[model samples]
Target: MLTSSHCAIEIVAMAALRQKQAFEGELNRIAGTRLTLEAQVNAIETANLNAETMIAMKKGAEALKGIHGNMNINKVDATMDQIREQMDISNEISDAISNPVNMGIDVDDEELKNELEELEQEQLNDRLMGAERAPIEDEDDEEAQLRQLQAEMAM
Candidate 1:
């Protein structure tokens, strides 16, 4: 009952509508893919930032550890120096105490025998009383000990 030209026109219109719908669907799919890719990129960027922050913190901790190690080594070196100084002072004191010439009388000198005997007795008395003479252990006590030893040898 339809004419051929009218039927042909209706079929063309239907085909055009189907092609338009397909194009619109394809555009929607492309837009959805773009959104998913953008979300993935943002997530990756956030992860990279977090990784960088963690690396920086680790480097800072390493620097602090290095500083602490250096400080420990310096402390050990300082303690060793102090011990060496104390040993040197002790050796000097011992050498001075053992010298016969520093004792003010030659070992073979019979002419100064009585004077030497008195000096020896005075030194013994000083050793016994020195600790009780100082009320406090102060720098003055160390100075007094050195002066007293020098005086004993001069006698």
Candidate 2:
């Protein structure tokens, strides 16, 4: 009877030990699976970050390309050429106004005065003789002089 009881206790202890070992094995498997899943999640996050960086770089490159297109060297040169031409024209006009001699616009004062007096005399005679009066243009002396100067400059 003593030997039988001892065998029964040994059998129970062995079963309990096997249950503990199976539980530990199951926990180890679960832990290993969790670690693998975490590693995969980390890899996916890193890939996403790299993808975002690549997309940002592409966008920046596109923006630079647009700027380059808008600021092309040929267009810049053409615009500068137009500006230079306008500046030259402005300078020439300034020179012409400041110094008429540069544009060969010389006039003899005596000759101009004599011609003006003759025209005035002719108008006076026409008014005295009761000639068929044409419609007057109402031009002042200064305006007439300016017109005459412009005509001379045109020549």
Candidate 3:
């Protein structure tokens, strides 16, 4: 039979060993959990970085689109300005041609009148020659005939 004091001592030593083992197991579990948590955190951070990069790229693309749109608008405005300038020039030329006083004319002087008449005749001749040189097309009649031919072909 064992003594009570010896039994108590043996029980105390076993309890201490069990406690130490439990503590070590808990520490290992905590370490594993902490490692897993760190890995998940790193994965999330990488995903966040990727998302941010994509967003920045999207913004850059949008900015490029806006710039392209603005460039198109500017091109249109430039073309309109050119057309307006051409129209203004045409108006100025027409005005100059129509105004006899602007042609350095003294209508009261007979010699100047004769010179103006000669100049006017020359201008009329040039206009006639230009008209004769232009190709004359009866567009409406030609288009109607083309349509009729197309209809006949379809039939």
**lDDT of all predictions, in order shown?**
0.91, 0.93, 0.92
- Candidate 1: give its CA RMSD in angstroms: 19.7
Question: Which of candidates 2 and 3 is the stronger one according to lDDT?
Answer: 2
Q: Please give the range of 10 consecutive residues that has the lowest summed lDDT in model 3.
A: 99-108
TM-score of each: 0.45, 0.47, 0.44
Q: After superposition, how far is residue 30 of candidate 3 from its true place, in Å?
A: 0.9
Minimum summed lDDT over a 10-residue window in model 2 is located at: 98-107
The model with the greatest TM-score is 2
Tell me the lDDT of candidate 1. Answer: 0.91
lDDT of 2 by residue, 1-155 (tens): 56988999999999999999999999999999999999999999999999999999999999999988779789999999999999999999998888645356678999999999999999988886885766577999999999999999999
Which stretches of model 3 miss by more than 4 angstroms? 70-155
Question: Compared with the true structure, what per-residue lDDT tens digits does model 3 show for residues 36-144?
Answer: 9999999999999999999999999999998786677779899999999999999999998887774574456888889999999999888878884765766798898
